[model samples]
Target: MRILIAQINPVVGNLKENKRKILEGIHAARENGCSLAVFPELALTGYPPEDILLLPQFIDEVKKELKEIAGATQGIAAIVGLPRANAKPFGKPLLNSAAVLFEGKILGFQDKTLLPSYDVFDEMRYFDRAEERRVFLLFGKKIAITICEDIWQHAALSKDVSYPLDPVAEYANQNIDLLINLSASPFSQMKAERRIHVVQKAAKTLKVPALLCNQVGGQDSLIFDGYSVVCDAGGRLVRLGNGFQEDYMVWDSEVKADELVAAFDKTEETYKALILGLKDYFGKQGFKKAVIGLSGGIDSALVACIAVEALGKENVLGVSMPSRYSSEGSVKDAVDLAEALGIELRHVPIEEPFQSFLDILSPEFKGKEPDVTEENIQARVRGVILMALSNKLGHIVLSTGNKSELAMGYSTLYGDLCGGLSVINDLTKRQVYQISRWINRERDIIPVSSLEKAPSAELRPNQKDSDSLPDYEIIDTVLEAYVHDHQSPDLIAKNHGYPKELVCDLIRRIHRSEYKRRQSPPGLRVTDRAFSIGRRFPIVQGWV
Candidate 1:
């Protein structure tokens, strides 16, 4: 049997568009002489519809679109993920379900067995668990279908959660010919490799070919990397779809295919993921132009490069807002970088606004010496200038704060943190340098001076980041252990041979900055633990 894996990008809550895409996939399947076409989880209404699933009228519309899609499946069979209303009326209002359509009507539904509730997932709040496992006999082939989290039970990716019942185990000894999964899994650093292990394990256990169709495109902070995969019955990969974009692959069970290698390396994969995320964020939101503050720093330079790549250089505006404390070389670097990218650079001096603020606050601080407050005023002045341009022009601002700065509370709230979206808020300082170097491997698109300079805010004279926080290497290592890995500060200190006092102090700063992050713009999530979406902390907690 030939099966079509349709990896599609669906806008959340756009029912008509999603239905059109599903019908398009179904027609393609029939035209290609394929027996079955599979779509990603929640393909109809889009993944994680969130509160949209709570609307009764939304569910009614979904039923309407689903039936129209079912009508188009005359010559082919299709498995589509959607929200199905619960008839029992005792548990939740809807079931995270997959509709199996064949001929001209609904064949059956395989409800999702496991509903993840941790991290970025809150399916337990909306979806009810499946009542039973099912195996369908189609075209003389017995196929067992599972949702995204159903197959994930085998891998046990999370230590805090475990399911008592295994969905794949229930399909064992059934002599199934194929196992198919519908997934809308989000992208992380190594999540794609981990997903392969899960699929391979399932294929080996069932002794049948396994296939997964995943969602593509970005929705808010989440970027879905659609590397839909297929493995043989012996647990070996035979087909791999495209990453960070929509793709379709037809797999023939009788024919043997060559194994495919991973498409991009770690840094390149991350670069592409950010590009896709930024592109979809603007594309889906009807945003046509972007404006970024170019401070001649690595973080801002990287964000500018990514903005130019996502929204064309013509669509990106780089503004250099230099203050009195800003060095001439830093300003020149910003101009050179903009010239290299072929984008319009606007020079807006913040000295006027900074002096105005200082004059106004002079009486309020008559006896007080110029301190961090004066430095913060410079940042807020720049923030106001950027926001003004953003208001007058139709371009959305892209913030340049990286994860490391945001972690240590080094950023000024309502100042450096001002933007419509945070492009690199999940990437650490080390990652920022790494991706910038990768961008300049062939040529120096980003200025070499910007890459090699000491990291600074430039709000004060000779204000190096090292004066306030640890070295970038040390800060990144400590953050990887404390923030990402959830390791204790003492353990991190012991493992890295760092001072225990310094490690504890850094963790405290992270804890104290919860309120600032809460007000920051939503950033693209390239890592598993991002500040705004996945990781939640109490602003008033005393755990530290």
Candidate 2:
């Protein structure tokens, strides 16, 4: 039997288009003489439909589309992920389900056994766990079908997941011929290896071939990398699908396949993930042009490069808003970067507006020394110029605040934080440099000066980032432990050999910046624990 894995990108809430994609995949699979075709979890309504799943009309529409999709499955069998209404009138009113369609009819659904409620996933809010596990016979082979988190019960591979039932393992003695998992797993650093390991373990446990069909494309802050997989019975990878985009592959049981080994470069993978995320964010929302405020700094430079790559240089516009504090080299770097990028460069000097603000606030600050308030005016003046361009030019402003600055409350809210989207808010200062250097590996794309220059906001004279915050090395280390790993300040300081007071102070800053983050634009999430939708913190909390 030949099984076609259809890794598709589905826009959430677009039932008609998603249905069309599924039908197209089924037709293609049938043309290839494949017996079975598989799609990713929640392929119909898209993964993590979120509050849309709460709408009865949306579920009803999905059912209508599923019926049509079932009727189209004449020459081939298909397993599609969708939301199934809970007829029992209990347990969340819906099931995260996979509908099995064969020969123009609807077969029984295999509901997702594990409803993940951590990090970016909140499926338990809208879905109920599967009551039982079952094996189905398709093309004379007994197969166990699982949904995203259902097959993630492997002990060593599970990331903080604790489930009572192992859905795939339940069919251990049932003589299953294949184990299939339909996934909408989001992309994070090193997630592909973990996924490969999971499928390998499942194939070995079942002693049968295993396949995974993952969803692709970006949905809000989440980017589903479609690196689908197929593993042979001995737990070796046979087929690997495309990464960071939609793909399709067929695995034939009769044809012997060899293991395909691959290595993932962290920097390259992250760059691709960000590119996809940016592309989809703009494309899905009907955004055609992007306007970035280039400060001759690393953050804005990186965002501009990514925007140019994702949306084309024609669609990307760079504006250099120079102030009194901005250095001549900084302004020159912006011009050189934009010229090299082949994008339209507009010089919008904020010096006039900045001086105006300082003059106006002179009376209010009569006796007060020039402090962060005066510095913030410069940032806010730049922000106003960017917003005005965005308003007049029909382009989205891309904010260029990195994660380290965002974490330590180093950014000025309503100033540098003003944008429709934050491109690198998830990447730390260290990662920003890493990716910037990687971009310049072959040639100088992201200006070597931008990479080597001291990090600064240029809000005032000689305002290096290190003057206010710790070194990028120390900050990134603490952020990885405190923010992502959820380690305590004392433990982080002890483990990383940092001063306890410094660590504690950094943690406090992160907590105090909750209000700023809350107001910041939604950024592309490349990390497991981004400051986006998943990591919830209270702005008024005193927990720190």
Candidate 3:
């Protein structure tokens, strides 16, 4: 039997378009004379439907789409993932399922056995754990199917006791010939290698062929990198699919397994993940154009370049929103950078809006002297103009704040924080500078002045980031220890050679800004623990 793994990127909630892709895959598999083809989990409605899963109408739409796909599977047998619902007695409705379709008929169904509820996943909120294991017979082979988290039960260890169930081990004892797992796993650096090791270990121990299919594309902050693989009963890889793209590969059951082909190089994989994330996030949302406030700083310059790369130069609009406090060199640098990227540049001075806001609020601010409040007003004015252009032109605004600023509460809530997406919110200030340098290494897309100039908000007459926060090098180290390493303030201070008081203040700011982050837009998650979805903190709590 020839089995095909269709590693595809489906737009979340775009039922019609997603169905088209699924059909296209089926056609390709049939042309290759494959008996069975498998797609990623939640292929119909996309993965992590989130609150959309709560709507009864949305669930109905998913079921309708599944039927349409089932009808298209005339000669080929396929397994597709979707949400299944049934009426509950004196409780919430049942919403869990997967479909096994062959010759336009539903052969069987498997509800996901495990519901993950931690760190950017809330599957338990909408789905109940399936009580039974499902096994299906196809092409003279007994096959067992499991969802993403189901196979990871062995790796999930508790401090005191072992897990009661091992899905792969149980299926191995049943004389199953093939183990197929579908996943919607998100991307982190080095995650592809870890996934391969796990699958190989499982195949070697079980002595059964294993097929792994994963979803690709960006959904909000999460970007799924599809590196699908097929391993033989001897734990040797037969074929590996492409990473960061939509690909389909067929593995013939008669062919012997071979050595594993190494996945994409590290930098190449990271770059592709960013590009795919940016492309699909905008494409799937029906956005054809994007707008950004180009401040002639490294952050905005890098974002503008990435936007031009993701969306064409014609679709990207770069705006220079200058204020009374803005430096002449910065404006020149912004124009130069836009020209370098061959993107259109527009100048929208914020002096009028800034003064108008001050005039309107002067009465309420009677005796209080101007401070960061004035600075925030300038930033908010720029935000308003960018948002106006975005609304008028039907373009999504991209916020350019990096993780370092976000961690220090150095950004204004509705000012720099206003946008449909935050591209580099997971990247620290140091990483931003490094990536910017990399962008300019081969070609000069970003102007050198932008990199050489001292980083500033340009919100006040002589505002520099150092006025409110420590230098980025020091601040980023503190943040990495606390946020990514989960170190306490005292521990971070001792380890990083920082003053205890400063470390404490930094942690306090991060904790206090939880509310602001909760309201911020979704960003691309490059790190293991990014803000917004992955990191959760209480807004009304006193615990440090």
Indicate the residue-level lDDT of 479 in model 3: 89
Q: Give the root-mean-square deviation of each candidate in angstroms.
A: 0.9, 1.0, 2.6
lDDT of 1 by residue, 220-312 (tens): 999999999899999898998889998878989989888766545889889889999999999988998999999998999999999988999
User: Against the hidden reference, what TM-scores do the models get?
Assistant: 0.99, 0.99, 0.92
Local accuracy of candidate 2 as per-residue lDDT tens digits, 176-260 = 8888999999999999989999999989988899999999999888888899989999999999999987777888987899889
**Model 1 ranges off by over 4 Å:** none
Model 3 stretches with alpha carbons more than 4 Å out: 86-92, 155-164, 263-268, 359-367
Best by lDDT: 1
Error of 2 at 236 (Å): 0.6
Clashing pairs in 1: none
Report, for every candidate in turn, its global Cα lDDT versus the true structure: 0.91, 0.90, 0.83
Please give the ranking of all candidate structures by lDDT, highest first, separated by commas.
Answer: 1, 2, 3
Error of 1 at 402 (Å): 0.3
lDDT of 3 at 39: 92
